[model samples]
Target: MRDLLKISARYGLIGSALIIIMFLVFYFSDENPLQELQMFDLFIIPIFVFFGVKEFRDRYNGELLKYWEGMTTGTIIALLIAGITALFLYLFVGWIDTSLLPEHIEILLGNLEETRDKIVEEMGADSYIESYEKVKGTTLRDIVIDSFAKKIIIGFLITSVVAVVLKRKELKPKS
Candidate 1:
């Protein structure tokens, strides 16, 4: 367990740093950081999870891995990355740039308008109205929660597959 956590924390911090750097790059480049976070998760989450579990199995666990160990390692790394990224976003939007939230809301509104007809047809006018209102009312807490939720969920799914693939039992010796 100690080895698991130690390895997980190491990989988690590394992953978090990379994600923060990516966020800063997007912010400085005038791209949407929120969108970038979502896009990057599709790639980064799987990679860190894989490497973290592999490291534990190879370096710490004598080339043996349990399904749960892999899952836990991947999950911890994902959680750490998500948590640190969310905190950075919160501080940035809350303190540094107060306009980011409004800008995001505006972008969401614009997208809703663009898809208004399709949304109404597929869901309903009420649904569109509700969504519009939700976007307008979105808070920093909401954004952070949403982002964290997405990351953790994606992480768990990737971890599940990784754990299955990486799990190894010790071979029994002849009696």
Candidate 2:
């Protein structure tokens, strides 16, 4: 267990740092921080988790990995990355540049309006109004929670597939 956490922490910090750097780059470049480019996280989490689990199996576990071990390692890394990124987002939007929250909300609302017809047709007028209100009332706390939740959910799904692909059992030697 100690080895699990140690390796996970090391890789987790690296992943988190990379994500934070990406956010900074987006922010400084005047690009919308909540843009579709954020999807890059889908790739980042899996890569780091894969390497982290692989390291544990190769360096510490005699080249054998269990599904649960891989899952646990990936989960821990995900938690660290998600928690740190969410905190950074909270600070950046809540304190660093308060204007960003409102700007993001406006952008979301504008996009929502652009797709009003489609949303209404698919979900009905009530659903469309609910979505509009939800976007309009979004807060920094909501953003942080949303970001954290998304990372965790995506991380778990990716970890599931990774664990399956990497899981191995110890082979028995001839008696």
Candidate 3:
């Protein structure tokens, strides 16, 4: 448990560093948030999964145990990394651009409103539009929670399959 905690913290720290580097480069170069975060996310998965597999292989023998260990480790690491990344972004945005929150909120609401409006138009339903309008103010906390929850689900889903493939074991022939 101690070792697992240590490993988890270490990965979080490493992930924080990666986030800083990626975001800094993006910010300095005036990259769009979607382009930067999306690209960064795409790049991080393989690296995280590699570490996940290596950690599990170091501790376990059976394939099932290896799979569980890898998936668990990956999921925990992903969550820690996400929390750390969010903290970094929160701090950076607070420091560099306080307007970021409003900008993002506006963008989100606009996108959601547009999508819901289109759906309502297609179905000729007033209820769907009314439902979206009920939430007049969307907070950053809500966005973060939704994003984090999605990341947790996605991380577990992807890692579970990778864990099976990356399991290290030898099979004996039937006699």
Candidate 4:
């Protein structure tokens, strides 16, 4: 268990570094921030899964029990990584550029509302707009945390089965 925790911590650290690099790239680039964020999200899923499987393989000798262990391991790593990133962001962006968050959050909410309205309008469910309006109380930071939680949960659940299947080891009979 100590070995597993050490390996998991390594995975978390490496993943956090990669995320910081990506964010730095986004900061320097002139491209649309939303597009850059989407791109980051697209690549991060596979990265997380890869580290998850790697950690399981390293610690358990390619064997897992019932697959759920892999998922649980993956989720743990994801949460740790997300927590670190959130802390960094809060310290740097929240504290350093306090005004930036509110401005960007308002823009994001407007974009969300517009997209939601369009979807409801097309689907002929105008009633949902009232519910969507209720979203005004939420902030971008809240959304980020919620998204991280959901992604970690679902990603771990799905990847756990894949890891177990890919890395399971068979027990040998005693002589």
Candidate 5:
């Protein structure tokens, strides 16, 4: 477990660093937030999860990996990345850019009508209104929760698939 954790943490740091750099660059450059986070969740993190698990199997696990082992390692990596990300987010919001939280919240509030319009078609007018009200009142805490939760969830989901794909059966010695 210790070795796995060390490997996972190293990979998690690489992934998180990539994400932080990309996020800061795009944010400071005024690129679209929607595109930036989405791309990171979809593309960047999974790539590292793949590498992390592959390395664990090849370098540490005798070139064999169980699905659960891969999944657990990847999940640990994700959890580490999420914790780091949350800390960074708190620092960025609390110290680096005091306006980040408010700006994101404001953007969300601004999209309320658009979101309602889309949800109303699928769920119903009542649901949309309820959701709109809930979203309209979203606080900084809510954003922080969502920011970390989304990545953690995405990481788990990605790892689930990646682990399966990378899992290798251990070869037994010949009698």
Candidate 6:
């Protein structure tokens, strides 16, 4: 557990820093931070999850990693990464630049319009519009929840796959 915490903390910091750097890249560029393509940047979390578990096996566990050990390490990495992301989100929206969020929400609404049109056409005007309005009204708190919730959920799935791949049982000698 001690090794897991130490390894996860370091990897989690790297994952979180990458997210913030990605945000800054978008925030500075002409591109909208809320752009759908930015979802690709989320690949960092899984990468770190794999690294954390792998390091635990290689550096501390004597080249033997049980399925549960890898899974737990991955989970710890996810939790730490998600928490750091949420904290940075609060800072980004609440302090670093509050105005960026309103603009981001506007972009979110603009992008949603085309999808909303299709949804309305398929389902009904009123139902889609109502949901669209709700989405457009999203607050910074909502963004915080959304950003962390998305990472945590996806992180768990990635951790599961990584754990399965990385798990290696110890070989025992016949007595």
Candidate that scores best on lDDT:
1
Q: Per-residue lDDT tens digits of candidate 1, residues 77-159? A: 99998898889888988999888888888999999999999999999999999999999999999998998888899889999
Among all windows of 10 consecutive residues in model 4, the one with the lowest summed lDDT is 30-39
Q: 1-175 in candidate 6: lDDT tens per residue?
A: 7887889888988888887777778778866554542484367888899888999999998888888888788888888878887888788668978786778877767777868768888889998878778877888888888777888888899989998898888778989
List the global CA lDDT of all models.
Answer: 0.90, 0.88, 0.63, 0.61, 0.79, 0.80
Which regions of candidate 5 are displaced past 4 Å? 32-35, 115-125, 173-175
The sequence of per-residue lDDT tens digits that candidate 4 reaches over residues 73-112 is 6666676676776676666565664554555556756776
The TM-score, computed over Cα atoms with residue i paired to residue i, of candidate 2 is: 0.94
Where does model 1 exceed 4 Å of error? none
What is the alpha-carbon lDDT for the whole of candidate 4?
A: 0.61
List runs of model 3 lying over 4 Å from the truth: 1-9, 31-39, 55-65, 94-96, 109-117, 123-136, 170-175
Error of model 5, residue 95, in angstroms: 3.0
- Estimate TM-scores for all models: 0.95, 0.94, 0.70, 0.70, 0.84, 0.90
Poorest 10 consecutive residues of model 5 by lDDT? Answer: 31-40
Top candidate, metric TM-score:
1
Q: Using alpha carbons, what is the TM-score of model 4?
A: 0.70
**What C-alpha lDDT does candidate 2 achieve relative to the native structure?**
0.88
Which pairs clash in the backbone of model 6? none
1-175: candidate 2 lDDT, tens digit per residue: 8999999999889999998888888889997676643697888988998899999988988888999999999999999989998999889888888888888888889999999999999999999999999889888898889889988988899888888898989889989
Q: Rank the candidates by lDDT, best first.
A: 1, 2, 6, 5, 3, 4
lDDT at 37 for candidate 3?
71
